[model samples]
Target chain A: MSEKNKYQNRRDFVKKVGKWAVALPIAYLGYELIQKTSAQEFVWQIDPYKCTQCGQCETNCVQTVSAVKCMHAYEMCGYCDLCSGYLRQGVKERNTGAELQLCPTSAINRSFIENPYFAYTIDEELCNGCGKCVKGCAAFGNSSLYLQIKHELCVNCNLCSIAQTCPAEAIQRVPNSKAYNLKDGYKPKES
Target chain B: MNKKILYILLFIFIGWNYFIYGQARFPKPEFDSGYNYPEYQITEPISPVWEYIDVAVLLIVLTLTTRFTLKTRSRKSIILISAFSLLYFGFFREGCICSIGSIQNIALTLFNDGYTLPLSVLLFFLIPILFTIGYGRQFCAGACPLGAIQELTGIYPVKLPKTVETILSTVPYIYLVLSILFAATDSHFIICKYDPYVGIFRLNGPSTIMIFGILLLVSGVFINRPYCRFLCPYGVILNWVSRFSGKHLTITPDICTNCRLCETSCPYEAIIPSDLLQEKESMVKSRKKFIIYLILLPIITVGGIFFLQMFSENLAMVNQKVRLAKELRLEKENEIKAISIDAVTFKESGSTLEQLFLEEQQILERFRKGTPWAGGFLGLSLGLALLLTTINRKRDEYKPDQGKCYSCGRCFEYCPIHLEKLELK
Candidate 1:
């Protein structure tokens, strides 16, 4: 065999090996990613049932305003004229007054629905996840107001500060698939 | 055979659309509220299973695209595949978990050991680069939804001057460095946050992004793949990889005739004229300049580091923790009239101001470390670009510029030699 032909064959072999060199690492990385995902690891989540409405979610989060937001269960809410979630405990009137508001941010918007019912909506942008409303509602009325981590806002931190300080052990790792546990059918325990 | 393939692709496209649009009926809620419910709720967190499906689809599409680009080299087939990808990856997927945005995920995973990126994000990041190394940006030709959207809207592309294009091209490199730096430090996903087309894909987002998307589409009418050309960080990586591609789509199927017929055919200005070779004296001068530039590279890098160090406070503010710290400080100084929600929330947490300041100091230190790295990388890229411009290489015929050419096959039709080859086949 000629020397040139041998060199040509070697070049071809090197080219073939180069292709595999690139392909193998990528294939291995893809496999690793798949394995990691399929492992069904735990994701950060909040248990509404166990939550004590301590307002730690507002302060303990790594994010500035906290990923935990007060979600109102409209189905569970009675839409009463005198909503415990919206008004302070010692308020004289049920009317929408700035001073009578429970939420420090005044995030709760109350509207007249009927003669006796007033619809309440939580403005998510303004609500600081302080759980002041949730505490008020759980104590005096239906436990419709609860805190859940908005997954969109959450970075899914490895060590959740809120979870660490939670008195009721309310915050726990859940499967990524069922990260959020809604309060749609939640029945508050009798105090 | 090509016609059959096109028909099959079209059929799959229609079938896929039908499958996506066909939703199963669910029972109405037992309790009805008087208030009108939103037609669609907030985006549900994507399940791991769905992520797996997206990865599988991306892999299949990438493989098919590579095969079609290398084997058939048919413009029509490429267009059909691109259109299908546009519908499936762009509209159907709603542009989430995109390769362009996945750069952030990969960066975060690399820098932060605690964060585990999903399988789909890894695939989305790697597959395109792998494909580019093997087949020279076949991913960009059609498979990229971002590119596909721009390509579709590119009706009458007017070529910009080479100088302007060169200057504009530097933006992506700087953007790439900044995005990676930010992501690595847990600052923000600026790439995903600013993705103009994400709004268009989901059919709703911030009005600012919506307006930006509209403006980009409008510009696309006269500029070919504006985002891909000037702003895509992922494109920077692909371009780097494609420089060493084993096989690439040639403008002419056989040999170039040097007829200059297809010189202006590429709207992207990816076609290189054979007259770029310079005289020996000019080459000598350029070589000298290249050496001088090489020596200045490190100086440039150091300068960049110092420049970025000056803005460390500003850069650190991208992190919410850092921003909160600053806000709290201002509130303490009585600079702020009302206590911000962030400041109030921190005070309510019972955490001490000293602790907050300590945390803020640590975050600032991280930024101090990260910004220099970003600046250094930016400097290196600038130097490399300068070196590339200074170096002169000989070329015999009009050919597609390897880095800039997306292998869209637009020039294939214009090449008589390519046409003849097709006819013979």
Candidate 2:
């Protein structure tokens, strides 16, 4: 071939090599990211039955405020005049009073439905996940109130602090599909 | 017009009076006896399977769009696909798990080893950029719901001045850097937090964000994808990749006839005019300016680092830890009359103030290290923009600006040569 053709061929080869040099790394990085993503096997969650209400969720979480929050099972509630979840153990009267409240933040809002029937609702914003109410309810009432990690608020930490310190071993890594274990018929594994 | 105004005023007066009277008629509830609880509705989260389906649909749409844009160059197909994307990606999906917001997820994952990124998020972030490298930004033409929403509303877009457009385009780079910085430092996802159109897609959000969404749509009527052009951080990546794509959309399949009929076709003013005359003196002057800018680039970058360091405290405020630290400090000093809820919570948790201070210091250290990188990136971008402006290129015919062009195929309808070729075929 002539001098011009040889130079042109060399330039074309360089251009092709340069294109691949940029393309290959990007393709490889994308593949690596995908691989890393696929290998993510666990999601942080709470086992309702195993939880002993140790109150570690209040302090041991990596998040400044723990992702664990109180969820009310409205169906399971008895709507009694006096609720174990809302009241302190020994009170003079079964009326709503500042001193008689079990929750430090007064998160449980009690409303009068009728003469003897009153509804107890957990005000989520004020709940600190200390499990004082859950502990009180399970000890005396229908075991309606339980602790579960709110997935929306959770960052899905790799090593959960609450899990590490859980005396009951209630916190466990589950599949992402079953991240939230509700109070309805869900059982925790016996350790 | 005067009568219409009087009628509107009269209607408003009657409505106001009616509302006042209606309020007075209803007796207030006894707060002591009965407390009304707002009905809390629990929304079921969208299933993981559906998210995977959305990803699949996205990939399929992107491939089809690339084919339609580069191979067929069919405007009709593009419009049809864009409408489909709007229905599925915009209305049905409610615009979450989008590529624009996924930048934060990727940044957070890279910085925080504790955080594991979901598969769908990684796919959402990478797919469009990978596609852009091979086939230009066919994704921008029709696949992206955000782009499609604004594109459909671009009815009578007014061409902005080149200088103003260039300056506005720099905003996305700064936004991208800030978004990554905030996400990496575990502050907040600024991109997702400030997304104007996601609120519109979901049909409810903070009133301020909803109003901002409405304003963006109103502006879209004459601004031609204002968010995509001037605010989208993901678009910056697409633009860079599309610049070097092997195959890209062109106005005509055949050679140009030097016809100026397609001159005013593009609403975005992306068409570059032919440079027929040689101005040697101006070129020499620009070359000197380019050299000067090259010399000043490092100095500007170093200055940016120091400037950002000065505002480290303000930047660190974005992190909750830093803000809580300050609050605790003030409370201890008696400077704050009321103890904040977060500070109260910290004190009650049985953790020592020294531990809190140590955590705050660590977070501040992260910000100190991260902000300088963001500043350096911004400075580099500025210098590069200046360098690009000073560098002159020779063009013999009207051509599309490779980085700015969306491959919309509007100019094809105005090209006589393209029309003639279609007729002959």
Candidate 3:
């Protein structure tokens, strides 16, 4: 009976010792990690400057519809009535015709502001992120129309599929505070 | 006329280059009319304060689960908590930065100083392990939404053959080694990449993963927690810590009646029955086998290191940057006939080939150093598992297997003693 009691006591001591021995290192790592944890939360976003309008954003998203949407940087818009962004390349007329518009979904809403200026606001609901308008806009107009991962739409996947297959490596992990990388304002805001 | 057309074509070509490089060809227009430009609209990411609430909620749920499983021994209460966990943690939170995936974050932060592990994520990874050490795998009982979802679906649980179960159980240890190895080398987190439940929780993912999630759920009805039992890398760590738990859930509240009713109750096959009837092995032969395995462990580890080291170069190609470097190098050397879009992008990015080659070499160096560590850990685990099978604890009653039991309280209902106590209450 005494021998059994002593054996149980020894087992208890070893078990207790083993528990803390493993726990301490893991807990210490947790403490160290907590100390090192950064205040800034980084989320995936498109780097507008690096983006080459490869059209992968439309197809490669894990979601049925891509989280990537075309954003109009009104600050950088040329506001031309004959905007290449609105009308296709080498179009004779600048009317809002289905055949003439660069956007496949006719997402670009062009409103006449003045004699030669038209405000192009994108209907995000309709935009497929094909970057057709962005490509045309960059060719002959101010590259104001660009694609960004809409926070409202994006599920914030850890490793974004679009980022993985992006030929340009345009998708970057930007501080969440920076939010959208607008064409008017890029992240790490280059000169 | 031809000369004139050629001159105009040259002008157009020059204009196109200017347009591409100029960034803004038709500059911001000056509007004489009073027209206001719309303010830039950008939506915010999910608030960080909510993340803190999630951590606090995780702590509360884990505490409740531990108490219910260990002290109360009520399967009904456990079911209630698991249902809530499935709704809140699984469906509401959409399962990002899960405890399972957090293993990669910790691994990555350990090796790469640049990557910061969030406090909430660190807590998510740590609290469960701590709770598990104190009270055996209470988290797996109901606190983990992944397990909760599986538990809920496990209506017609089937016990797998012991030999097949034992063989499949080694997968998580290998997964843990590979996940840590990938993270330490700054490669992508395969844990999150291959997670089956997150897509189900979010209701969206690649079609392949969605199909896999559906398949897992379908099989879960019969096989019972196919992932938790076989694939979860985090389960390997939790199982190890749980073996030394201060307290663990018991099948019977008091002395076992040995009626064998509770023996088949555990859906996870965690109830180890009495070994009194099993044929006993010769003591001398068993002892010698134990010593042989102990001696074989180191030799296996060294052999594993060498074997994995041989394939380090091939494994290094998993990095996207390394693959691109090889492609661009081949294109430059005229080994590849066609230039890919990635090669063009790399060329235009202003980074020289020398710099890319150097980065690739560094990444390969990391893989060379890291692969051996993973292989050694796997080999050691294999040796330990083999050794464990040879030893048998002489028990005359049924009991929950410490490392394997999820503490779900399923066996409590089967225990007539506990049922009488509940009836008295």
Which predicted model would earn the best DockQ? 3
- What candidate 2 gets wrong by more than 4 Å, as runs, is A1-25, A39-70, A73-80, A84-175, A181-191, B1-45, B277-281
Q: For residues B1-425, write the lDDT of model 2, one tens digit per residue.
A: 99999999999997786453221222222344554543432322334676688889999999988888777777888888988998898888777678888888787777877667778878888888788777788788888998988888888878889789888988999899888888888777778667788767766555677889899999989888899999999988788777767777877777766677778888877777666643433878999999999998898888878877777779889876677888888877977843654565566556788997999998899889988888888888788778877867655567777677887777877878778876887
| Total backbone collisions, model 2 | 0
User: What is the Å distance of residue A85 in model 2 from its true position?
Assistant: 6.0
What TM-score would every model get versus the actual structure? 0.73, 0.74, 0.92
Alpha carbon lDDT at B245, candidate 1: 75
**Model 1 steric clash total:** 0
Interface RMSD of 2: 14.7
Please report how far candidate 2 places residue A91 from its true position, in Å: 13
Show the lowest summed lDDT stretch of 10 residues, model 3 chain B.
B18-27
* lDDT (C-alpha) at residue B423 in model 2: 82
lDDT of each: 0.76, 0.75, 0.84
Q: Candidate 1: which docking quality band?
A: incorrect
Per lDDT, what order, best first?
Answer: 3, 1, 2
lDDT computed for candidate 2: 0.75
Show the colliding residue pairs in model 3: none
DockQ scores of the candidates: 0.10, 0.07, 0.51
Off by over 4 Å in 3: A2-7, A185-191, B1-22
